[model samples]
Target chain A: MSFSPLIVRLMETLRCLPGVGPKSAQRMAMHLLERDREGALALAETLQAAMEGVGRCKRCRTLTETELCAICSSHTRDQRLLCVVETPADVLAIEQAGSYRGYYFVLMGHLSPIDGIGPNDIGAPELLRLLDEIEAEEVILATNPTVEGEATAHYLADQVRRRGLKVSRIAHGVPLGGELEYVDGGTLAHAFAGRREVTA
Target chain B: MSFSPLIVRLMETLRCLPGVGPKSAQRMAMHLLERDREGALALAETLQAAMEGVGRCKRCRTLTETELCAICSSHTRDQRLLCVVETPADVLAIEQAGSYRGYYFVLMGHLSPIDGIGPNDIGAPELLRLLDEIEAEEVILATNPTVEGEATAHYLADQVRRRGLKVSRIAHGVPLGGELEYVDGGTLAHAFAGRREVTA
Candidate 1:
């Protein structure tokens, strides 16, 4: 016999999560039912609030409940140095690195022609508008190193240069603390090609 | 900078599920916000309903939205042969095998003295009462083969035997279709000790 209808429904609904499968769904359902009913209810409330209330920041397009995300509204950040990235998660990653003082423009995705995602779909026009409005001096393209990311970066770089603004793509090479022996061939070649002369 | 307050709260709440960690929680939150708001809302509603509606079946203690679980209420099931299991997931496993026709008594957990879990915590007394009420001719101990599970099975077996009912434990040996070379030493020993004679 199958589980109770509600239990079955809960398990099925749980599969919407990225990595959860049938077994993991079942285990999560059972765990919630058995041990953490309060936490389950709290999670439900939080999920509902987030889905309905969280909206993109009007300026940067990162997720926020307010009209402007905290980064876009802050006066202390270097607004003239805007970093464009693929997703809001990338914004978080750079912030956690704790070095960058610039504001961000979240593309939310890259241009994927095979999937019919074009400039408008990734808010390229909005980004151009923001660049003109903010008159940023330097724009850093921090999209991932994938082919689509590179293509998107190049497209945005051309647009920024046409507006007479400096545009630079993030470096791609062997990662810091990564050993050369285990580095992939493509990355090793890129590292060699982009090698900088040592300056003391 | 951290994520939006609601996004941060959602990620923290998502960690209540089994096997989810900080990184997975963040990914789930971003995925739901970015791609699947409908699924996130549906999952929230289902989680709320399940947490509030599902309760233990009065007869067998398995999770159910009603007073009795489907197995406990079914007339076709062999009420005279009862299977005792440590958790509702165990009951699901046996039912999926599609061979056992007996009804089940779910303990929800096994006896673990070090964790301060005793007979009452696992509903051992309720199981004994069920045995008296059902007058089952045979009781199957389907608890896992772990030390605590074995102790619980022996304890329950003694109680059933005192009531003059036949009690048997499920077999422990090399699993069906498992290679002998890959089987562990404990299982190999158990298989050899429990070997049956050929009757051809």
Candidate 2:
């Protein structure tokens, strides 16, 4: 016998979440139905509000309910130093690190020609327009180190150079606290190739 | 720098699902916002509907939108046999195995006095009332093998026996496909104690 129609539907709909499968969906649905109805209802309200209200920031393309995101609207952030990344989550990661003081432009996704995603698809034109409008002296390409991310950064770097603005890509090397024995060949090669001069 | 207020709220609310932590919550929020807004909205609607509409089945107490669950309402299931389980998920597991064709009575939770849960809290009185009203000649206790489950089954068995019904606890032993050498000592003892004579 199957679960009631509503229970089944809830389980099926829960699979839309990343990394959630049939078993996890069933467990989550049952957990909500059996234990935490209040939490489930609150989650529903928050999801609806976010999905309907959250939109891309007009300036940086990061997710925001208002016209501009927190960083874009802030007066303290260095607007002259702009950083570009792949997704909003990447922005959060940098923010949590508590080092970067510059504003960001979210690309949402990297270039994927095989999937038919182009410069226009990832809002490249909008990024370029922001470059022209802002007084940014430097643009940091903080996209991931994957092939597609590298290709997207290279393409954006060419565009930034055309406007005579300084452009730089984030370093790719061995991660901090990583053991050399466990480090992969490609990372080792990058680490060696990008080695910096030691200070006296 | 943090996510916009709405996005942060969405991420926090998404943690209500079982096994989801801060990192998973952030990934899910970004995934829904960046890649699948439609799926996010649909999940929200389904969560709301299920949270508000789904209720306990009047007969079996499994989750359902109607008075009786599918198994309880079915004409094909055995009315003279009743299986008592700790949760609705247990009923689903038994049903998915495709062996049992009897009606089920969900206790929602096992007896756990440490957590302040008592017989009345888990609907034990309702289960007894149902037993008195039904034509069930045999009752099966299919609660988990944990301590609370064993105690619950033993208590319910006494009540069923007082009413002159045959009640039996599901067996505990080494599981199928598990190696004998790898099985735990308690299971080995249970297997030895519950051994039956083979028919010639």
- Using Cα atoms with residue i matched to residue i, what is each candidate's TM-score against the true structure? 0.88, 0.87
Q: Number of the top candidate by DockQ?
A: 1
Which of the CAPRI classes, incorrect, acceptable, medium or high, describes model 2?
medium
The DockQ figures for the candidates are 0.81, 0.76
Residue B104 shift from truth in candidate 2, angstroms: 1.3
- Candidate 2 chain B worst ten-residue window by lDDT: B191-200
lDDT of candidate 1 over B1-200, digit per residue (tens): 78988999999999999899998998899999999999999999999999999999999999999999998888998777888887787777667656678898999988999999999999988988988788688887767777788788878877778888777766566565432223454554454345332211
Q: RMSD to native for every prediction?
A: 6.3, 6.3
Tens digits of per-residue lDDT for model 2, B38-148: 999899999999999999999888889998887888898888888888888777666665556789999998889899999998788898899889899888877776678
Stretches > 4 Å off in candidate 1: A174-200, B174-200
Off by over 4 Å in 2: A174-200, B174-200
Candidate 2 residue B38 C-alpha distance from true site, Å: 0.8
TM-score of 1: 0.88
